[model samples]
Every structure is written in structure tokens, then in C-alpha cells.
Target: MSPQPHEKRQTLAHRLLEVRLQGRAAVLKGHHNTNYVLRIGLPLAVVLGVMPFVRFKYRVPLKTVEVVPRIWRSEVDVLAVVCRHLREVPRGFAVQGDRSLHRYRRGIVLSEQNPHGPVDENMLREFAAFFVRTAKVPVKELPAPPRDWPVDGESAKFLHWLIEFTERRVHLPNRERFGDLFDQVGIPADAMAAFKERHLSLVSRRFVLLHTDVHRANVVVRRKGITVIDWELAIYGDPLHDLATHIVRMGYSPTERRQMVDLWERAMQAADLGPLTAGLHDDLDTYVDFEYAQSVYPDVMRAALGLPTEAGDEHFRVAAERVWSAMDRARGPLELKSVKDVDQIMEALRKWHSMDAVSAETTVV
Candidate 1:
């Protein structure tokens, strides 16, 4: 009898491991995974029934999140649905242990290609097209959402859930460890509550698949077109949330941002997805504001945690600048009383660094 699907996965996984152990795999560092790329040729190539030189990406998950859900768990299931309908997405292969494998597309990443500022009109339209395609994916086909995920078209409730997730899972859990730093850096503990109060109402629109993290780094510019990778953060929710995240993460200039929004609306209308574009003008900014507001916690925490053990003035300066930038973007949305200047932020970092070092030493002893 032919080997079952799981058996085939195991066999392919074993072969990939042998290659990785032999040091034939090229390594790339990612925030959540250590990716090893291998050009699987010969008998293994036949296993996928493709060409001899098909490359594959092998990912080993890092213990990056304390309480946040393992992204790959949702990512694998989401990809199964997306790959069935879209060809630009990478085909998820299998998972073994905490590691997984998928087809690796060869091309320059959009970030590397553009490097800075806005993309051209052609690229922008392609982005809109991709978004429309993603929106058309039937909700029933998606894997079950998390407990208490807002029902479809409940935009206000959806935004509330996201804020609660950030506050509850991302912020509150780390408050003990990072609270002092947050206070010193001018971020009030009540920032989220204030945001919730200010943006209490949002216009309802149909929920669709949202690639909540569609930055330039996650997009590969291929000969055929641009292929968006990294489905790890995909979620079902307000479509505007996807656009808002894309706009902020892509760092589009004011004119380009406006143009992109127009393109998106036009594309959605043409595709007969007008219901998804409901309240495009009135409520889009709310989603954009929410993106900025939620990002501050992670950005500040990461900057502080990124400091080297023996970090110097230069290292502190970099971390402080990162924190300052995140806060500057979020200040309005979060309704902060004040934002710390770089020097003030640096001082806060210094204090946190000292405390962290002491904590580490105590734990070791």
C-alpha cells in the first residue's frame, strides 16, 4: 500500500533533516524562526512530483512569545485554505515537532527592491488585486477562529477584541516585567482604556481574511508578480484592518497612501465586493489608529530587550530612538499626556537595563 499523507510527510521531513544536518542548507534568520533553505534534488524531488531543483524552506520555531498563540498553528490551517484558491502563496508542506516546511519562491523581496518610500502604481494595483482575492475567500473555509472572536460584520466588537487581546495577552501579562519601563517612557497604564473610550463606535463591514502584517519584507517581487509570504499573522476580521496595517507597515507617503486607498476601493467595487468596503471613508482611520496604538507595547518591549548585555551609549541611543519613534506614531491614538524625548527615553532604557541585569544575576545565583 502507498504511504499515507503523514507517512509521506515524515519521510520527506527525515530527508530534509539529513540534508540540514549535513550542512547543505542555507540559513536565514527571522524573528520567529530559523529558516534553512535547501534545493531538494533527485529522489526527494520526485516525492513532490515537481522539477529536480525545487527549493524548500524549513523553519524551526523559536520560543519568542510567552503567552501569545503559536503563529504556525493558525498559519498552517490558513495556508491550506489560501493555497487552494491563490497561486501566489507558498504551499505549506508539513510540520514535525515545532518546525515546518514549505515551498520557497525565488525572487527579490519587495523591501529589498523598493528599500524605501512608496511603490509605483503598477505594484500598488497588484497589492489591491491581491487584497481583493484574499477578501473573496469564503469565511466557512477558514479554520475556526479563537474563542470569543467577534461575529462577521461586527467592526466595533472586532476592534474591541483586538485591543483586549493586546491589553490582556500582550500588555497585562508583561506588565510586571515591563511596567516600570512603560511608566518611565511616558506610557500610562491607562493608555488602552483611553483609546477604547475614544473609539467606541466603528461602522460595520463584512469580515474577511486579513493579512494583518503585510509589510514590504513579507512580499516577494517575482517575475510573474509580487507574492506575499508569511501567513503566520492572518486573521478573520474587518477588511479595513488589513489595509490599515498594510499602509502603516509599508510606510507609504501621504499622497501614496491616499492613492492606495482609492485603488483598493475601486478594486473592491469592480469585483462586486462593495459590502466589504462599507464605511471606507468614515472608519478606516479608526483601524489605522488602532494599529499604531497596539504596536507601541511590542515596539518598546523589543527595543529594551534587544539591548546587549554590555550595551554602550550607542546601543542605548538606537534602542531609545526606536521606542521614541513608536511612541510618536501612537501618541495621538493612545492619547498620551506626553511623549518622551530621545534623551528621556535613553534614561528610561538605562534604568531598565540596570534592573534587568540585576534580575538576571539574581536568577543565575
Candidate 2:
């Protein structure tokens, strides 16, 4: 008698879990293929052929789950491996670590089954507060951000690098990429050039630890507290970039988004962190706009996956258009003077949202 294919896969999964978990006491609690609950475990060691980095250890009670439709189950499994590794390291935010974890041989297939729904406004605010608190911690004390230390006049440069890096096909084709929906909308090349030119310098501000992918799905609300997972994209960068990414991905309404921004401002102020000054806020708005503009790139996934290009293009076009219309309504004339004016920033946000609305309508029909 021999093990069947399903049994073999399960055996491999269990073996991988054991190797990854080392001697840690963990229970496989859920029926999902890649789900487990690990309570009170020491960090697993990563044994390289050469020197072994001291794995950061944390005893936090953790539950890990990864769900991928049949089409993307393989890719999801790879992602789950990375997630499991991160869970072993203490001080690991959602995005931080070596580039090896960033690479995957396959692309994700996103459908209604895999769609990330809009985050609730209240949850958005709470996560915003949590992110701000986590980000403000001095770098030396925790995991360093994924890039060079922040130098003045390099904010835009950093952002450009990130956008380019994210767009690169080597890591993941823009279309198959999870977050490249903005590139699909038909923004004129000139509009994109102007948008980038106007705000490339925004990246030069103070850098902080950022989750990089702070969307609702990455955050799991548990009875203990909000536990943010997935740090493959975590980096040391502009805090607002993190906020903009989360807000855009969450797909919140303009009014709800605005309220979340207000909550972010108040939380920062109350913490004596800093004012949400006008320039900074506008810069965040611009980041959101650029992200919206690039949303269409994800349409490329259709061709990559051997699906009908026209249908995929149409789907991406609609998504990009909606986000662009929202941006149009959310943004205003950029009056970014300093980094503390909350009102001016909110105006810009209003315009961005308006633009996103137009794009959204175009996407539908």
C-alpha cells in the first residue's frame, strides 16, 4: 500500500510545518489546508549551510491561516511558508526581511471568491492608530526598515523606486500583482508624469516602520487585539505611504475614508507624535492618487494566466476607473506648505475620491 496524492500532499504539509515549527508546541486546529494555531512557542531556527542568524523569538499566542482558491492554491502555499517564517521572528511587522521571501514562481488569481472586501471605518481607524504607534518606535530598537536611512530630499526618489520595483515583472507581473489595480485606468501619460513630478520629493520626510500592506485582509481582529500578518512588503518608509496604501486597498467610501483620516490625525496629535500638517497630508493624497493611477496594471494578469485579455482588461479598466473617480473627488489643488495642516490635506483627499468615482463608473459600463 502507498500513500495517495492527497495523503502525500498532506504529509508534505505536515512535515514542512514540523520543520518550520521546530520543537514548538502547535496545534493544527482548522480544516483549511493551510491553517494552524500556535500557542506559547519559541521561535523556529532557520538553519542555513553557513552561519545562522539568531531568530528573534516571541511567545505571543498566534493563529495562522491562508486561503487560496483552487486556481491559486500553489502560490498561496508559498506565501503561507513566508508567513510561517515571519511568525517565528519577533518584532516582525507585516513587511520586513530579506528579498528571498519576496519572490514566488506563480501569480495570484483574484476573483469574487478571493476578493478583499472594504474595511469597516471603525476598524480602519483602530488599525491606523495601531500602525502609527508601531511606526513611531525608534528604528534601532526594532527591525530596521527595508532600505537606506531616510535622507532629506529623497522621499519621491524612494517612492519612485518602490513603484518601479513593484511594477517589475521579475517579482510579479503588474497585472497578476495583487495591488496594481490603479494602472488600468486610462490616465494620460502626461497626467501621470505631472502627478509624479509634483510629489516625488514627498518621500524625503522622516521614515518609519510601515506594514506596507495594511489592508483589511492582512489584519486579523482577534479577541486579544488586532494582529497584523504578512510582512513580505514591510519596509522603512513614509508612514503616510502605508496609510494611503491601506485606504486605497480597503476601498472605503469618500466620507468613510475622510473620517478615518481624521481619526489618524487625532490619534497622532493625542500621542504628541506630530501634526498631520498640510504638506504631509497633501503628499499622502498625492501618493493615493498615483496608486489609483497605477491600478490598471493588474489587468496584465489575464494574459499571464492564459485567460482572455479583453475580459481581464475590462475588469481592470472598471476597477481603475472607479478608484480614479474617487481620487478626483477626494483631492483639491495641492496647497502643501508644511507637514501639519489637516484641513488642506483633507481637501486634496476629497478631490482624489471624486476622480475615483468617475473611474469606478467607467469600469462598470
Query: Clashing residue pairs, candidate 1?
Result: none
User: Positional deviation of 151 in candidate 2, in angstroms?
Assistant: 1.9
Across residues 142-192, which tens digit of lDDT does each residue of candidate 2 receive?
Answer: 443334444523677766755554345322432233222222222232333
For model 2, how big is the CA root-mean-square deviation? Answer: 14.1
Candidate 2 whole-model C-alpha lDDT, 0 to 1: 0.45
- The lDDT of each candidate is 0.84, 0.45
Q: Write candidate 1's Cα lDDT for 94-193 as tens digits.
A: 5555566678988998878887966899999999999999999888999888778788889999888878888888889888888999888887788778
Q: How many clashes does each candidate structure show, in the order listed?
A: 0, 74
Candidate 2 deviant stretches above 4 angstroms: 1-121, 142-153, 166-195, 275-278, 302-365
